[model samples]
Target: MEKDLLKTPIEFLKGVGPAKADLLKTEMHIFTFGDLLTLFPFRYIDRSKFYKVSEIQSAAAEVQIKGKITSIEEVGQPRKKRLVAQFEDSSGRVELVWFKGAQWIRKSLQIGTEYVLFGKPNFFKGKYSFPHPELEKAEDFVKSPMGGLQPVYPSTEKLTNKNLNARGIAKLTKALLPQLKGVIHENLPVRLLEHYKWPSRQDALFQVHFPTSIEALELARKRLKFEEFYFIQLSLLLQKDRQTVQTKGHSFDVVGERFNTFYAEHLPFELTGAQKRVLKDIRKDTRSGHHMNRLVQGDVGSGKTVVALLSMLIAADNGYQSCMMAPTEILAQQHYNGLSELLEGTSTRIALLTGSTKTARRKEIHADLLNGQIDILVGTHALIEPVVQFRNLGLAVIDEQHRFGVAQRAKLWKKNAVPPHILIMTATPIPRTLAMSLYGDLDVSVIDELPPGRKPIKTVHRYDSNRLQVFGFMKEQIALGRQCYVVYPLIEESKSMDYKDLEDGYESICREFKRPDYNVSIVHGRMKPDDKDYEMQRFAKGETQIMVATTVIEVGVNVPNASVMVIESAERFGLSQLHQLRGRVGRGADQSFCILMTGQKLSNDARTRLETMVRTNDGFEIADVDLQLRGPGDLMGTRQSGMLDLKIADLAKDGQLLQLARREAEGALKEDPRLQKPEHAATKQFFIQKHKGKVQWSQIS
Candidate 1:
């Protein structure tokens, strides 16, 4: 068999001509034989059991019966025409109906001929009928390759119009499989095959398309899924290995004065065990002289900022400047103010650069940054500008790193002669399985514990009927010198509707609280940036007892005095958004409360989300549930990375298999890092072909 046979254009296949091939390519992206072969079936139907006409029940599902068409006729008016045929077996008879393809079906029907029929039985007024039944001669059915478990390929309306439906695709696959007998090379090594006791790639592909039994189909799926995951893990692990050995970075070898003074004297609170463990990991990475591309994941308000600040202090102690880039200006400003206050009695210098910075201030900042006078600079995307050059940038910290693209992050690497050590942080807790698949090329550290003296936010669910009681409780809390946030959902597609809701809610709250006695601040996406910032500052300064707005303050607004979070139309938000909004109030030592408001009617998923929020404050647990509910594609915007484009394996359900694949890939690389061994020749060849002409973005975190 030739190696390029599978690469042949799909139009060259026996049954698929140019017209059908064009439809396949345009509708399903199938351009070659290899692409068609790998288009695995989403489901299968068992055709082995044949039911007698007398045994058919009204509630019966899809069934096959051996019968013959005794009579045929056309019924109903011209526009509502239907082809009806009386199909008879040993005991009784059933009607086979076709509503749309009457002319072609009626002409093809053979009277008094034994045929096999398959379809779901629909129970009408007093009889069971099969609609659009698939009819095949008994002798032909016996000789067909797809007799037992039939594969059902996905199709589009355009493809189906050209006779390229599931059955049509099955015929093409059956034709292509025979040609692939010896052409499908075994990519896994013999040792791995023997250890896992799996079938060869050729046999698995065949069995997946046309299985003899349920067990064979299961085994085939397992083999293919493992192969997919194993190759992905192998690619990511190889990237990490190359980056570690080839990339050089600055070595911070000393525990210098700035770090010591901050840790010993000015530390606000004792570091948690998890934070300490992560710091130790960072310390090891920086001292190894290899560029550090590490991700630090912690829940909201889990003290990640403290870890970032300490790491930057280490860079300053080594006579190198560090910069922290945020996704939004509000977050950048918050980080700048927090870090400056934390370093207040020390000699370390810090500055902020954002889009709103004055021209004079910008020039001063740029000059100071070039002269190495600014020890640490923090800002939004402005930090990545061409003018913001660092004299000797030893480290770069990114907050909410997922919000930035790979190209934007790569720009930071070009700032210095050698790329600075990268520390990426995210409050959106990614499930471990997703993290392994998405960020496997980078080292990961998780701060799983919250700081001391912080209490878990109490969460509850309430319908609109309880609005008065909720408002009364809010007034009581306000009288105690505490602040509150009343947030409404802001969906992009329904912006006007959401804005109206916000406005109405704000007016009613103002009427209930009565302005002079209780001041309320409003902020939303439509407001000017300056106005939004002013409202937020008013609330932050304790001038407003209640802040009514949208989810604009979801990420970076920090007011420790705000102890209550009231989310309206709570069912409209995702679990992560709800969790982030709840995090806004728990920053202070006082007991924070999150009240979810919804209507009487709720979806099952919405109920589950509300219950989960009330049951636990664990971000990881919530993230796991979110992954199961939303899948890996929508979580954390990972779809943009193109890494999660999996064909068969599911990140939500394949965690154990993913772990096994990671372990196997790691072991294989450790034994033969370059894959020069004879046993790994197939794997190496496949990797090269898969990654050919692809840009390597593993150097950027």
Candidate 2:
């Protein structure tokens, strides 16, 4: 079989047998040679040089040394065994200690024999030592291919037992590289290659796997990053373009003067700068000849809904119907209720459609919508049903882009005579570079400023030791006629996390608040739809003061009365998620506070996260920090959320690169909109070849 082309079973790969193959495929989701090759390492280690015995501190770290074993001893009992070895090189001496699994090392090591050790270098009493370090004989020295720069692939505890480490990956790549044809596929234009100074595809692949120098590694990394960002930008713009062509964006002549007069005379409150800016942008898009594929992003409580309402009003005043789709039934009901109150005396028709509605009622609503009797229809995914149709759908606004699928988008488009202008909204603020790269196809408007009189939510970090204090604060808020939210992470993802802790948390709260009079509604992944709706409605109505929930409540169902949000074990959460939870509060007029309770022992990254939460309320700034702290895959559900399709780019650290790549892609699209010619052949082929994993990767184009 050709080395690069072979479809060898993972079991046949060097150093892997049936047992390890099972572990790889079952535990780590790794299968086949190609799958292993694409499994990029999560991190890398630097082993530039050997450390001096005198320089070794009490701190624990891996150290490389040339040493000979001077003495050996067994110290612990049979039940908990430990082996200790004394070593001395030409310069100084150190000790090697093994715990629990001592016999494996004892057999691997012989008295007075020299060996290489990799492990935590520690000093005890007066001598330098390594506790239970990885030991190998002197003959194994030549086998260390990763002596300097090493990539550490993500692994499970089960796989580590099989000794399938970085070298195993290198060996596999080595076997496969030569099998690749000499004149392998080239998917980048020659002009692009010259402008970006990119290496050939074969060279980049080989160098990325086993780079000979730092420069080679950097070149390989850059080529891959460019490809990643370019593909993502291309996908986004393509999707946007496709939507633009498909949707006619029926022209709406909204009488803004009346709206302006209404605002100037009876607006009642001052229009926030953000609101004005967003409204202006919306009006321009609605009136433009081309379809408006725009995304409106803002933080929670920044009045994004009002801007959306005003945009819908533009469509309504133009004598055309509009629709707003929310992810949940509760939110749809909420929007209907809000609109019914806001447009009480106006002729703009408003109706609600959800899965729970009676068949007769849904049919009537659908008929009314078709006859232009209803001006605006708000609902859950039920809005996409084939029977639901609009008479003159001029503007369509979708809240929370992630919740709706492409099938739904098509469903939405079919509702209109000339498909409505698309307006997408999100309460989450993504980094600018990422947004441009990801949503570049659509026009983007950001409401960066919060409304006046909306006080920033006071945030603080606490340890488990201050549990009583947190409970005290909760009690005070409850007594003050305010409600609280206790959010827990999903118990288990896909039977992956059945959080006994979730129910345990609810039970504990039931025990603590202790008063039978206090109503606490519990909601988690296990609950039925009605149960969840009941709990949410109860909480919304203040029938229940505190609602214990999972992150499911992060997106919709706004409560102006909830003022306190207490997140337990908050360190377990990412920065963006923490911000989202904080967003659940601060929506009401009463002063709001977010308490992030963590454990006493926190990792460095966790510390930075806690500090960021306490030090600022800026969502964009926090998004930047989140990107820096965590790469795209872990930051925003990139893998599953289907939003992030980056292959080699880091949205946080590689913003400049993303910007440059997006500029190039956008320029390329402008020159040849379809990328059908010889000039764009390479880029198009690259997208087809490389950006097809995980998500459909269609959203990028």
Candidate 3:
């Protein structure tokens, strides 16, 4: 066997012809022999351990037993026909049955033979039975050292249809191992292998697929998991070091009149300690004359917007233009209005650009932006349009940064000769492990404290039995001159019959407090843009006492006077969404409340989510629990697929392992930053091969 042979098409393997090869390729993406070699097992079981019929107690437990079949018989009608066999050893006797492939099994197994049987045993009516136990002659089974762990591979029905189950896969792996001996090249460096006491690449692969013992399997798994995490950390660290050396940035050497004037005259309130700390970090990056790729994370109402505004002002004072990109038009408009009010008497000119901008205003704004008349430009994805050129764009602030794609952010780099400083802000706090893996290449700054004078929102859980009581509470809050939001989970009546249920709830609310006494504004995704905006504005302006909507209002809806958030079917929503909806309230000075209303029956995960919401308003804690419940993919949504390319490692469970991997990667880089040493060549080559065709976000940023 040679290196080229390992790369040979899997169809060349024995017992796998053209038809089976095609099915393997289509179903499992196994094109080459090497691909099949790396399909590791998900679990393993003891093969040597045997049990007697008298030792069986639990029906759910699988056991291996040594016995001889005394007799065999077929029972039941045509469709329900089954083959049953009486198996007996010196200790006891057990019945074995097969519902599928009974005729084939009957033909394959012989009676009056000493065979080793392995299967799960079930007990009913004081009798124990083994269903379709694996049958092999005692002498044949004894020849193979039959006491080690057996590998169980992940398989699909399509592959199983082609007679390629877990056992079949193990057989193929057993066939391939002989060829791979002395053929697998070492991927990790010699020093790393010696220091970690890890096995060679060949030994790890073989042991992981077919282990001789439990200890060997554990060592094999550790080696592979470490390799997976090490490469990711190496790539991120390399990109980060490259950015610091290669990308030059506009230096805001002095915090002059614009920043000073806003701080002195138009400052909204005293900055919180977390806000001050993050601002200090940003100031240091801007002053260093190196491109700043930083992420600012804070919970809702943590005053992240004020921090963004202050950073933009620093860019302005340095005689450079700045822009802020948001995920939606509503959010962009909110930023524009808030910043406009903050800089009312300032000399800096701010402009807004979104999809709905008028043609005449768009032309004026474009002209001003190109010539540097507009000091700061705030907009949605429209800021990335071809015509949206800027004059010396020094800083770019992205709000709800996860909503935008890498390519969209890359477009902002073309606005100037040099890439502008990037400061990404997210209100949904990310757990530490997720943040480390996801944004490891960038500088992370967390704003952990809310601004002073903001009281924590009082959260309560309620059942459907207290529907009238909850409505009365809402009425009481509204009577006190505050607005309320009633959020439902679904929108379409046809899709979720519960949409009709929500409509009935809405009708009841209207009927209870009718006419001029209480005007309610309803908004959802189905409504037209104008209609939705109209309703939102009415509620924001205090013209409407209550706003009924869906999760579209989860982000960017800032109504300071709103004090109550009544979430219907709260169990149906995730922890992050529920937190964001609750954030809509508690923005004002008055005491705020969030009522989580759900049915009596709740799932374990759903109950944990609701309890976490009620217990604390800490976004980081919620995010950690959410990660444990839904994993990184569902928590981060669609844009995280490319970034979280973990194959063998688990982010939630392997946080400590990831930290060790990152430290190892960093130590290696510190010793040889460019990996130019002969000893580092293997590690460098391994990284390139592992990350082929993948766009590294670190490089793009």
Model 1 spans > 4 angstroms off: 1-3, 52-61, 68-115, 122-133, 137-139, 638-640, 695-701
RMSD of each: 3.0, 4.9, 3.0
* Per-model lDDT: 0.91, 0.76, 0.87
**Runs off by more than 4 Å, candidate 2:** 1-36, 41-48, 55-61, 72-75, 100-114, 132-163, 191-198, 245-247, 253-266, 433-440, 462-578, 584-591, 595-609, 626-648, 676-679, 690-701
Across residues 18-136, which tens digit of lDDT does each residue of candidate 3 receive? 98889889988888888888788888879868888788889997888888999999999999999999999988999999999888888988888889888888897899987767778
lDDT per residue as tens, model 1, 48-102:
8898988887556888899899999999999999999999998899999999989
Lowest lDDT sum, 10 consecutive residues, model 3, at: 692-701
For residues 110-199, what per-residue lDDT tens digits would candidate 2 score against the true structure?
Answer: 777777766777766766678767666667676755565666666666666766555555555566566564645666677877987888
Ranking by TM-score: 1, 3, 2
Superposed by TM-score, candidate 3 places the C-alpha of residue 671 at a distance from the truth, in angstroms, of 2.2
Clashes found in each candidate (C-alpha, N, C closer than 3 A): 0, 14, 1
- TM-score per prediction, in order, is 0.93, 0.82, 0.93
Candidate 1 colliding pairs: none
